[model samples]
Target: MEFAADVFPGGPSDPSVLTQYADHVAGSVWTGEERLELKLSSHGKKVHSLGRSVPAIEGLVIGTRLSPLIACSVDTGDQGLLSSFVERWHRETSSFHLPVGDVMITLDDVSSLLHLPMVGDLHVFQPLHMDDAVQMLVDLLMVSAEAARAETGQCRGLYVRLQWVRDIYKRRCHAGHWTAASREYLLHLLGCTLFANKSATNVHVVFLEALRDLRYVVHGISYTT
Candidate 1:
């Protein structure tokens, strides 16, 4: 099945949640025993020494910018699997405005840190779909802003993403890599949503607006294409 179908076969109209998607993906490929063996085979002695561990567990998290979305745990000693989960989680949630806390991926003493990249342009790691790519970047900034404010209770650090976005916008405009429609969409997002000034606490508002606009653009592209 296609990635979207595997994750959301019901299509955009469906009310399926992210938890269900995570569960399905984690459970579908391998049985509990098989998953354990696979992890051991891959990691060897290091896997066995990761302290108390469990089989496999998966979770999904979703929430708006106001609150913590989902809090779940997985009990696996396999560091590799934990890393993969963190990477997958970043890919899936890179379009939202919420700042995700650490997702515990093990039941034992084993643990891994999942930190979203903070310094570079997120577009560098984006997939080929321009619409999704832009949305991912917008979301990353939103999350970074939230994290920064949550840590320091100030949004001034968000200026980094804002600055990077401005640089990217300028470069993209000069390169003419975007279609007229894409250009227009991005211009509106940058002009009306992101670059607009707002109070520090309301910084998430910019990201929310950008996200809403990106959703429309993606929908339009899907329908017309």
Candidate 2:
């Protein structure tokens, strides 16, 4: 039962944890009357809570400095199952970008918080493929950015991600981007995209350009509320 055949399993194409998390987030495994499955590692192997098995779900998300391209790939033979999962992924992401009410994920009465690292990196608490690792970190920034500019909100942590990306690009020898977190992130992101398929003396063109543009031309800076 392949999850989504359209995702093109290039085997870690985007270098993001978003791809690695696909299995845990979208699998068919169910909990004992629990709506959201809490992870449990057991017996020298990762196993379901009550011995239930479900196909793995993996997706990788990378910010193109200019746009958001979410890619998901699953190992299965069930196209129907994959399509449904893909649709949900798309919906959640699209809704996050919109300037409106958002339904946060909640478990019973508790909810998830922005797990930022001491040095400001969005921490990855679980193991993931090399590719999925990067995607998850970048997506977290997008989610945080929306929350920050979304009419009265406490989630300004996305700014940290925006800064982290710029640092990564600069250290890599690409031209330094803008200083304003959001605007600068957009500038380089768009710069990265223009050369996604080609590269010069060592810089990944697509990622760099996209990162550049995302810094300044992202969206309607403020959603006039």
Candidate 3:
């Protein structure tokens, strides 16, 4: 299939916009002094996504205020930020070692391709909120996963999607940005979405690498146990 000729046409090409998009997608908006002082715990607020209720695991909040994912501005030509996010996402989704057909996808490239079309130029100047970013990423992953499946039915697109989300949560934990509560919430969000969205597919080997290698069952199939 021929990819879009101009993946990011009229997209957020400005340094500030690019930085904000990257930060939101990478969950780096919660890192600065203006960051909220979240009082998260293993038990926390419930968040709804993909048609299920999930706690805001590893989320940052203050009192009754909590932001799941936020955006921040990055300096011009900050390829390092883009590179780091790509590396982390690649490592999490098994893209680094495994070849998904002839496609060697980089997060920076994939994101530019996947992210801009849906958002268009509306979000050029303003950074995307947490929900918008996740929604966009989810949409992009689903679309990309379908493309990958078309190219190579050798792998489950759902797995790739789940892994992408899983890796985001793991990166947040690694960055020390997420609290125990936030981690739990994010994991639950991912797990719930996986079960709800892709339950029809038979998943005999769903690995929750960040969740201490545990496993669970849904519809007679195994997942992040």
Candidate 4:
């Protein structure tokens, strides 16, 4: 049956349409084992493991002006509460139609909460060819072209495992390779915080360009977020 008819046989203009629609939506909610599992990542544990106490790493983080985030903690909060807010979110108005009032998270809220700058040229990503992605990964991460190709293959040419970036950091975060190590750490940081995905295991490699110069990291954060 058509969804609108199923929800309110009398049609949208009916006085009871809102009530009927709400009931229909509530009835459609999944329960118990039928409910989909929600994924959450605190990312604090991994961030602490980056050996931030080391002078070189500390200096790199300070230089990039992202030191404020080192102490930041994330709480997933109550899933049911979050779900209720999601249900009330009105995309047309870009606000939550709560019983109290309509509200939404604004860019100013993001800037204040995350302590990130709000003004910069926004980043625009285009479709990347597999070959170009592989080459970019090899150049930025200093990985072998064959290994880059293999990793890109696993994530449809646009993403790579966050763990892989961590591994690179482990190999490079030392006296001779600290610079490369810092870049890897920045990549991992961006993946865990700003551009986090539902999978929580992978991050888009397009961010590699942003980390090519440590000076631009803050500018990158402003625009990308």
Candidate 5:
């Protein structure tokens, strides 16, 4: 199917928006255990897409994976953030490698995409007191996963989403600027999100991979363990 028209007609190219979107998901998201789902109708009704994620899993996914996935951006607060995030996300999904769009998705990507929850773009930013960038990552992941699980998926329209995310992330890592404290905190948060998210996604990926490898259940036909 033809992908939706550019979400940011007057704002920026899909590639630029990809960078800004990832930044928002990484740093600004709230720090909590609440599942999230989002239907982003912003930037002049340009991008019509819906996504979701779980509170707990969001923490796990962002807190774990690394390299060309997603990242935090406290500098321009809109750039380089995606890289920080996907860097971790890619690491988390390393085991599955399912081709989650343009990016060869791994089991983590598939499962996370399968289970992601939904909320709204309004919730992307956390309260002032909340500074756990890692938590934000997890929450965003959960939301993304839920959107992915839907039968009418955004993924169907876009194949380069993952690759796009990774590319944006790389740009951020090389170009983003931040305070020493913010940098340190975010770095720490990145580690936290990486371990947490990767651990969670890996469990799902490994389990499914094992099941597939073992053929425990094929086409709904049960195989003896």
Candidate 6:
């Protein structure tokens, strides 16, 4: 079962060779008919729609460094193209093995593409106990303790439904409750855009830490993929 040097070239390190092999097998020899389907939800669209109606919180939004994101829309374009690139991703190399060569996404790319700040403290999240999670939700979101406990329980103390957050936003996103409204808006923005998960139904509760002090949201924190 010996393969000639020309067939494999630089062995596992050669992205060009690996890409060619993958293309040959996937395009001609592979028998599988199913293709990868992305599960990105319409959560971003929902957030954008809400942002349009919600009263402006310029000071809060600017402090959080998320003002740019408010104007952006999520466009999950060309699923087939995205899936193809996903298939070409090689974890070991941390890049895509494409015919053009190996390509890796850097922090600069994210900053430029999303119009987000790159200079800041690293965004780190720590898990919380159920009691702590519930309290934080109540304190930051202006929800009752009982309601917070129930929602935290539903997501195993790690997350809460974005729908729930949206509901809260609708009720409180006005001048009368600006402080609480700002917190809800930040949570919704992060969940629907930057830290979105596959489930699309919920957002991690840990993001609450960022909202505790709006002043630090922008210059104090930066997220990595």
Candidate lDDT values, in order? 0.30, 0.28, 0.32, 0.69, 0.27, 0.72
Work out the TM-score per prediction: 0.20, 0.16, 0.20, 0.76, 0.15, 0.78
Task: Please list the residue runs of candidate 3 whose C-alpha ends up more than 4 Å from where it truly belongs after superposition.
Answer: 1-135, 138-160, 179-195, 199-225
Q: Which runs of model 5 end up more than 4 angstroms from their true locations?
A: 1-160, 177-225
Model 3 superposed RMSD (Cα): 20.6
For candidate 2, write residues 66-111 as lDDT tens digits. Answer: 2231111112556565544442342323322122443333332111
Runs of candidate 6 exceeding 4 Å displacement: 1-36, 90-94
TM-score winner, 4 or 6:
6
Rank ordering of all candidates by lDDT, starting from the highest: 6, 4, 3, 1, 2, 5
- Candidate 6: residue pairs that collide: none
Clashing pairs in 4: none
- The residue-by-residue lDDT of candidate 5 on 7-69, one tens digit each, is 433222344323443333322332233434432211111111111112323433333232122
Question: Where does model 4 exceed 4 Å of error?
Answer: 1-27, 30-34, 51-53, 90-95, 222-225
Over 89-112, each residue of candidate 6 has an lDDT whose tens digit, in order, gives 765556786788879988898789
Which residue segments of model 2 deviate by more than 4 Å?
1-209, 220-225
TM accuracy, model 2: 0.16
Candidate with more favorable, higher TM-score: 3 or 5: 3
* Quality of model 6 by C-alpha lDDT: 0.72
Error at 120, model 6, angstroms: 2.1
Name every residue pair that clashes in candidate 1. Answer: 75-107
- 4 or 5, which is superior by lDDT? 4
Cα lDDT tens digits for candidate 3, 43-127: 1122222222123431232211212211111124555654444433422334332234323464455335423111122111234
